[model samples]
Target: MKKCLKKLELKIYHVVKGEKIDGVHAGVYGDVTGIWGDVTGIEGDVTGIRGDVTGIWGNVSGIRGGVTGIRGGVSGIRGDVTGIYGDVSGIEGDVTGICGDVTGIEGYVSGIYGDVSGIEGDVTGICGDVSGIEGYVSGIRGDVNDAKLTDNERLSGIDVSQLIKN
Candidate 1:
């Protein structure tokens, strides 16, 4: 039997939704993420990454890094969160993540939505949609979405205000 070292690395834990990765099944990696180790990397790097509680939406992204180990078609390093969900916007009447690295802030929604507008790179720990490195969706209380940022309001390290604020 193979030692499915699911939680072998402390970097990624049960961050994925509905997944229970254990070192007793030895799984593969790929784009068909459905649970904790599925597409064990970014949230929406190419398609789907769901966690609900923002536990593990998008972490290390891009098909680049060192030693991407896992089961399934999910290959890529979620090692240091090279890239998380970036920033984006949603059109009127839109309630889903259109683009950028989207993660559920708080709620039991179906999927993150974004339409018409899209972005590139991670938006896990900074402000503005064009920020550099791990882009933050919302890390602070004063964080105003870039899409919704007003000339009078203050922005922490999060953009998408137009989608968040508006």
Candidate 2:
């Protein structure tokens, strides 16, 4: 019986041992498992994660634990989705994304469709509140402390800090 058709083709599919799969697109299939996993799919997104993934289409992202994807966007810190469309910035804990947008200092998010800036911390997003004073924002929009003081006041008005202090 040819070893039962190679054990029915390894149980119909789902073979990714040792784990590291990347960016699969066009037509899509199934069976994604994980251990030290990293997956990236484009167009027809399929992502399954135990740890570490970067997806596209459906969007996933992660870190410190592992998982990252974009185009639909996801982000994380304690692990799972590290910001692209759904932006996650980190320091403490509590991160959520479903239209994805979060920024951090202390951390706590229930909803984000975009824009929730950071400085002190307390984000409940629907686009607003751009922070300052230890601000390092992620995704959705911009401001990042007035774009780093307008690029250091446009290179210190061309004086260039007295030619770098001579």
Q: For this target, which candidate reaches the highest TM-score against the unseen true structure?
A: 2
Please give the RMSD to the true structure for each candidate, in Å: 19.5, 15.3
Q: Give the winner by lDDT.
A: 1
- lDDT of every predicted structure (CA atoms): 0.37, 0.37
Q: Kindly list the per-residue Cα lDDT of model 1 for residues 49-90, writing each as its tens digit.
A: 343333445443453332222223222323343232333222
Model 2, position 57: C-alpha lDDT score: 42
Per residue, candidate 2 scores C-alpha lDDT tens digits across 1-166 of 3554443433534444543435633554554343343332234433453444344344234333321332333244333223333333332333233343334423333333344444233334435444342323233232223233445545657432322321
Instruction: TM-score each candidate.
Output: 0.14, 0.18
RMSD of 1: 19.5
Deviation of model 2 at 71, angstroms: 21
